[model samples]
Target: DTAVSQTPKYLVTQMGNDKSIKCEQNLGHDTMYWYKQDSKKFLKIMFSYNNKELIINETVPNRFSPKSPDKAHLNLHINSLELGDSAVYFCASSLSGTQYFGPGTRLLVL
Candidate 1:
């Protein structure tokens, strides 16, 4: 059984489009995170949710939003997508600071 899963693993869209990604974890972890991997393979945390409260990374833009309705699910929404926003988005669940990542959702902005 998969510990973490993401829906619509691939997305292709035009610039200025809005998109959302869904994630769920069965590990019963209290903390979940969203990460972005750029073309250069630099991975950075965008947002984290602990017990349904959000903790966003300061460097992340307001256009990126993360919502966690419960401990087992976290979803990401991006408004006005740009070319630079094209990247692999990963969802992770952590217990005691050790994280397990889901298969990434690759978004391509044309």
Candidate 2:
């Protein structure tokens, strides 16, 4: 079974559109996270959820939202997507600080 999985591995849309990416993990981890990798290969954490409670990174914009229905799932929603939002979004799950990442969802904003 996959430890972590993300849906719609690729997303292509125009600027200002809204989109969402879904993530699920079967690893029974208590902590999950959303990360974005930019074109320059810089990876940054956007949001984190531990047992369904949110802990968002201060640098993340309000346009980005992370929702967790339970410990095994975390979904990301983007509103009024901008060109700068085009990047690879990764879903990760951790047990005691050791993280396992999903394949990632590539978003392209035109």
Candidate 3:
């Protein structure tokens, strides 16, 4: 019984490498989102998909792309990872304003 799940709770990678984080939700929510929390613990919305359509895209780098195969899953792919990309990535879901987030995927770039 998983509400929201993401793979590799911790990821340590080298700069310029490409990696992908997978996410899935058991809740029947129509909207899903990806958020990034920096070292300061500032949570910011990166992307949001509603019914499989791109809804929100923040000032994230083009190297970061989000894919939503279905309402239950949204995966994030990063290319040419940088030290600044070393942060925690979170996947969330919601039908309205209230969203539920995953534990988070911590990426450490060296």
- Model 1 RMSD, rounded to 1 decimal: 0.9
Tell me the tens digit of each residue's lDDT in model 3 across 14-83.
9999999999999999999999999999999999999889999999899999999988989999999999
The candidate, 1 or 2, that scores higher on lDDT is 2
Off by over 4 Å in 3: none
Runs of candidate 1 with Cα error greater than 4 angstroms are none
Sort by TM-score, best first: what order?
Answer: 3, 2, 1
What local lDDT score does residue 51 receive in model 3, on the 0 to 100 scale?
81
List TM-scores for all candidates, in order.
0.96, 0.97, 0.97
Cα displacement (angstroms), candidate 3, residue 52, comes to 1.1
Error in Å for residue 64 of model 3 = 0.3
lDDT score, candidate 2, position 76: 96
Which pairs clash in the backbone of model 2?
A: none
lDDT of 2 at 4: 99
lDDT of each structure?
A: 0.93, 0.94, 0.94
**Residue 67's lDDT in candidate 1:** 86
Clashes of each: 0, 0, 0
TM-score of 2: 0.97
